[model samples]
Target: MEERQKIKVGISIGDLNGIGCEVVLKTFEDSRMLDFCTPIIFASNKTISYQKSELGLEINYNGIQEASKALEGKINVVNVWREIPAINFGEATKEGGDYAIKSLKAAVTALKNGEVDVLVTAPINKNNIQAEDFKFPGHTDYLAQELEGESLMFMVTDELKVGLLTDHIAVKDVAQAITPELIKSKVATIEKSLKIDFGISKPKIALLGINPHSGDNGIIGQEDDAILKPVIKEISESGTLVYGPYSADSFFGSDGFKKFDAILAAYHDQGLIPFKTLSFGKGVNYTAGLNKVRTSPDHGTAYEIAGKGKADHSSFKEAVFTAIEIFRNREEFTELTANPLKKSRLKREFR
Candidate 1:
């Protein structure tokens, strides 16, 4: 088999004062990671040096101005911002968020220009990152608008995959957002992602109910029966293997989610709460249905743990690996889909 070319992975330092630097540095400490892909971190050398000193890490990164100049066998750092911001750890400052957006903006520009093959982002403070440049709720929403593609906030672990139907919306507004059209679109995105990004040819999906006990047969709410049931039925009739508006409370407790390839949650907390409870530091938040690759650690910027050198880099490392795997899977899928006649003829032969 021919060896594939190394992919260039872009890194965005989330909140400068947060544990983003810690995890990013810890993850790249093992130089062997360079063999798989070239990592171009969109953070200043000053920031990285400060983090290394604070964490007492001896890891070294090659500083480069351009992502294209990133070298193999070494970690690369790009100075997104030249000015040194005050390093106030554990505090939610506007300066932290400003530099975080700067790093993200530069890395995103590189991603768009094909300077990077995939992007693995560290955690950011949503509140502080909220400004004129970044008015969106979070990275997924921002990336969706920037890339002109619909994004599904898909959380992935070894055992389970959960995709949110309505992301960053309030609990009170979730019921109103649970429409048939939204359900169908999100489920379709999940289906496509499973096939192309995950290499799952025929994905079995379970949709969690919006209300308690699946609306208790319309006693508590009507969305589960009226909207969810009809939509799942329609999607199933279209040859998709989707089932259930399963009650959220008992679904995971009964291990019901293990039966399907992925679960589509009605809203953010409905799916993410259970997912985080089950997986915690093991999950990767994958932005599915996008034309480009983007993944982040399931957890947030751990302000309490920032600068303590206690931050777990497991999820961040997993995010990088997952991004690479998904990118490879997408490439293979594109090649496989490029020849329709060949696929049709092969299907006839198998039949």
Candidate 2:
């Protein structure tokens, strides 16, 4: 494993028309960030220069053709594309989507090839990013297929952590998606991620009910009692410390969420609404349960404030810091757990 300070972070430049470049520039503008990790941005020099000119922020970045050549204590820009697409801030354009995918693909390739240590993605307009090559709903879906594990959209802050069982789905379809298999799978994913990524052992997890009031004992809906309750009990009995089927409405509002290490919600909005409300600018959208680490800002491409110099870079900065932290945590975890069983067996044989 590389040294903690030598972690190379690969960044995918998201929608050119949005605030991706703006916040990215703002993040690395502070030289102190370089002390932790080396950053390699996947975009053309022309695009970064133009964004710099627009934001009127002065920063220096080294130009590199590949992520392997990234320099320490300096921001590196990899030229994924030479032709500069038209930047239409405050608007979603096809070109913006096109370039966003290009950057993401390049960064993913580097990640798989071990050119970079971890990846921090910028927000993309999901509607505009639809194409044959990229048909998934969001980053989690795409990364799940490309990476090695089942991905969970975990929104996290220092005080709270919330993961979704089903993300980027319509409200009407959420109930049916909450099956026993899915519940177990998400629980396992969140549990493993908590142990390895966040370094939490014996993690206590809470699950929000799919139906309101947890189905009110089948008065409102049967899914919660018929499905969630039984499955959660089964998991808890297996020594995981899992519990729930709690009413979603009162869980966060009543401070019930503070009791656990993490909470798993049934669907997208149920988990995100409270998370954003409580920790919007400070939260990071971490794609947990993957082999490699990836994180993004909780906020999206704020087209309304795009290119106006009013965009807040706090979430993006947190995303970068979180990615670096998780990368180091994973390495440390691997070292500590490596060959434990083998050593145990060897001791018995020697005795």
- Supply every candidate's count of residue pairs whose N, Cα or C atoms clash at under 3 angstroms: 0, 0
Superposed by TM-score, candidate 1 places the C-alpha of residue 113 at a distance from the truth, in angstroms, of 0.5
- Candidate 1, residues 100-217, lDDT tens digits: the string is 8999989999999999999999989999998976898889988998775679999998699999999998888998987888988999999999998988899999999888999999
lDDT of 2 by residue, 15-61 (tens): 99899999999998888888777999999999999999899988999
Q: Rate the local accuracy (lDDT) of all candidates.
A: 0.89, 0.89
Write down the lDDT that model 1 would get. Answer: 0.89
RMSD values for the candidates in order, in angstroms, are 4.7, 5.9
What's the lDDT of the predicted structure labeled candidate 2? 0.89
TM-score of each: 0.95, 0.95
Error of 2 at 93 (Å): 0.5
- Global fold similarity of model 2 (TM-score): 0.95
After superposition, which runs of candidate 1 have C-alpha atoms over 4 Å from their true positions?
A: 339-351
After the best TM-score superposition of candidate 1, give how far the Cα of residue 115 lies from its true spot, in angstroms.
0.2
